[model samples]
Each structure stands twice: as C-alpha cells, then as structure tokens.
Target chain A: MINSISKVINDVGLHARPAAEFVKLASGFQASIKVRNLTSASAWVDAKSIISILMLGVSKDHEVELMADGLDEELAITTLRNLIESNFK
Target chain B: MHYTLVDLLKSEHIMMAVQAADAKAAIELLTAALVESGYAEPEFSVDVWKRELAFPTGLPTQPVAIAIPHADPDHVNNSAVCIGVLATPVEFGQMGTDGSIKLLVNIVFLLAIKEREKQVAMIQQLITLIQSPALLAGLISAKDKNQVLDLIQQTLNEEHK
Candidate 1:
C-alpha cells in the first residue's frame, strides 16, 4: 500500500468538474484507492465514487490523503498526486 | 460575497411535481425557470446541457435519486439554485461514469453559480442536505414549492453547525 498527501489549490476545490476528473482518473487504475480530507477530518472514502468525493467537501487549501493498495499502487499514487499538484490541469 | 444555500434558493425557482420526458427535458424545465427569473442567461441552458452530456451529474442517493446540473459562470447573472421535483422519474447518465451507468432521478437541482469561489461550498451544502434521507424524503413528498423551499431552508439552517 502507498499513501500520499496533497493540497487542493484550485478555486473550486474537489467538486463538480474537478470531482469528476478525479474520479475518472482514479477509476482507471486497478488499485483500490481511498481518499480522506485531512483538513476537514473527513472519513476515508472510495476515490472512484463521485458522491463520496463530493461528500468530502474539500475546499481550496484543504489537505487530502490518498491511499492505494494492490498492484500499480505506486503508479496510481504518483499519477493522482501529480494531478492534484497540477491543480487538476 | 459568500452566499448560503438558503440565500441562493427562492420559491420562484422551485418547481414541484414536474413532468419531463428525459434528462434534457428535465434540465430544460429547471433551466427555463432560472432563465425566466433573470438569474441565468439564455445561453446558460445550452452550456449546461453540453456539460451534462459530457459529465452527467446524476447521483444515486438512497430513498431517492437526484441530479445536480450546473454550468460555467460566464452565462450566469446571479448565483441561484433552481429545483424540479419530477412527478415521474427521468433517466440521467450517472456522474463519474462512461455514459453507460444511468440513474432514474426524481429531483433536479440546477445550480447557476456566478462566482467561482462559492461553487464548491454551495455544492457541499447541497451534498450535506441530500445525505439526509429524511430531508430528501421531505423534498420528494413536499407538495408545493413553498414546502420545498422551507425544507431546503431547514436543511441549510442546520449546516451552520
């Protein structure tokens, strides 16, 4: 298992379009991915679920922890961390 | 300026027991209300519809399914939430899917956000409201727009904590 933490810098945070983008990318990986909003102290939720991501209510400057388990966990963590660091660009 | 969910919702924007053929019709029905109320421009409908086609917003919540359709800020004159309670459920492509997953949505929340900063918080408020099956049930069973508005206000009021 691999875990990493990152900050959401986008103005809209992880809702709407950004949530969709995050879930879509997370769904492509075979590893089981989970994310929790550290800033909000939200419970860990499936990274591929849109509703779960939306429920996190992660706003700008909020820190989130992403965890991946199974094969390709490293790649998944790297890709998703890059996506967040790039502000979902 | 920061706006709460109650501040963005109005009785005029709430349509109860609406009947629509499909997702587009449901969106158009709510979009028409927002456009007519001068909260959103005419092009707002087109932009929102296009975005819906690409990234559907239907969420399969318990007790009832709902959809939150929104567009870019460019066509919005004011930030408002237009709601429609469909008398009969309509099929909407599930969000975070490859257009294959579908959900029969009974209610639609058309969010017209003029400010980028408020979008995430506004949606979070809605998400908080919908997570409550009791509130969602009230929204589904409420007979009139006033009742819907009241329920939403009640839910949002609790959001302050």
Candidate 2:
C-alpha cells in the first residue's frame, strides 16, 4: 500500500469538473484507491466515485490524503499525486 | 453557509410524474422551472444539457435511479433545486462512466448553484439526502409538492448532525 497527502490548489478545489477528472483517472487504474479530506478530518471515500468525492466538500487550500492498495498501487499513488500537484491540469 | 438544502427547495420547483421523452427533454423541462422561478437564466438549459452530455449524472441507486444535473455557476442567479419525478423512466448516461454506459433514470434533480465554491457543500447535502433509501422512497411516493417539501426538509434537518 502507498499513501500521500497533497493540498488542493485549484480555484474551485475538488468541486465538480476537477473531481470528475480525478475520478476518471482513478477509475482507469486497477488498484483500489481511497481519499479523505485531511483539512476537514473527513472519513475516507472511494477515489473513483465522483459522488463520494463531491460529498467530501473539499474547498480550496484543503489538504487531502490518498491511499492505494493492490498490484499497481505505486503507479496509482504517483499518478494521482501528480494530478493533484498539477492542480488537475 | 446560511443556505441549507431546504432553503434551495421551493414547493413550486417540485414536479411529480413529469413526462419527458429522454434525458435532454427531462433536463430542459426541469431547467425551465428554475428559469421561470428566476433562479437561473434561460441559457441554463443549454449549458446544463451540454454538461450532462459530458459528465452524465445518472446514479444506479436501488429502487429508483436518479440524475443530478447542473451547469457552471455563471448561468445561475440563485442557488436552487428543481425536482422532476419522471412518469416514465428515461435513459441517462451513468456518471463516472463512458457515455456508452446508461441507466434508466426515474427522477432528476436539476441544480443551479450561483457560486462555484458552494457546489461541493450543496452536493454533499444532496448526496446525503439521496443515499437514504427511505427518504428517496418517501420522495418518489410523495403525493403532493408539500409532501415532497416536507420529506426533504425532514431529511436535511437530520443532516446537520
């Protein structure tokens, strides 16, 4: 398993489009990925579920922790971390 | 911050047993409610339909499938919700899937959010409301607009906890 924490830098945080993009990317990987809003101290939710991510209610400058487990965990973690670091570009 | 789900839900915006041909028609039918009520601009229908074509909002919730459609905040004048309980199910592309994946949606919640930042919180509350099968059942079985309003109000009241 691999885990990392990153801050959301985008203007809208992980609200709609950004959250959709994140989930779309996460769904492509075979590993099971989970994310939690560290700033809000929220419970972990499936990273690939758009509804669950939106329910986190993450706002700008909020920190989120992500965990991935399975065969491709390392790649999944790195790719997702980069997506956040790049502000979901 | 002051607005809750109940605040956005108006009795006039709730429609039971709506008849529409497809997803596009369903969205347009509901978007009209928001525009007529001064919550959104006329362009909102076009924008929301485009967004629905892109991301799709259909959720495969048991007993009753639903779609929560929304557009960019720019087209909205007030943050509000428009509910459409379909008289017959319409096919909608399932959310988090390629456009090929579809679900027969029985209800639609057309959201018009005035601020981008508030989308997450409002959707969070919405998900909370939808996740409960009992509440969703109540919403679908609700006979009148006031009954629908009462159900949503009751659920949202428990949501703050």
Residue ranges of candidate 2 with Cα displaced over 4 Å: A1-89
Instruction: Estimate the TM-score for candidate 2.
Output: 0.69
Instruction: Name the TM-score of chain A in model 2.
Output: 0.97
Q: Write the per-residue lDDT of candidate 2 for residues B1-161, one digit (tens) a residue.
A: 64567778898799999999999999999998888888888999999898777667788886789998877666889998899998899999876554578999988988887754445556677887888787888878889899888888888878766
Location of the lowest summed lDDT over 10 successive residues in candidate 1 chain B: B115-124
Work out how many backbone clashes candidate 2 has. Answer: 0
Q: What are the candidates' individual DockQ scores?
A: 0.16, 0.16
- Candidate 1 structure quality by residue, lDDT tens digits, B23-77: 9988888989988989988899998898788667888898999998887677999
The model with the greatest TM-score is 1
lDDT of 1 at A72: 90
Clashing pairs in 2: none
Docking class of 2: incorrect
- For every model shown, the clashing-pair count is 0, 0
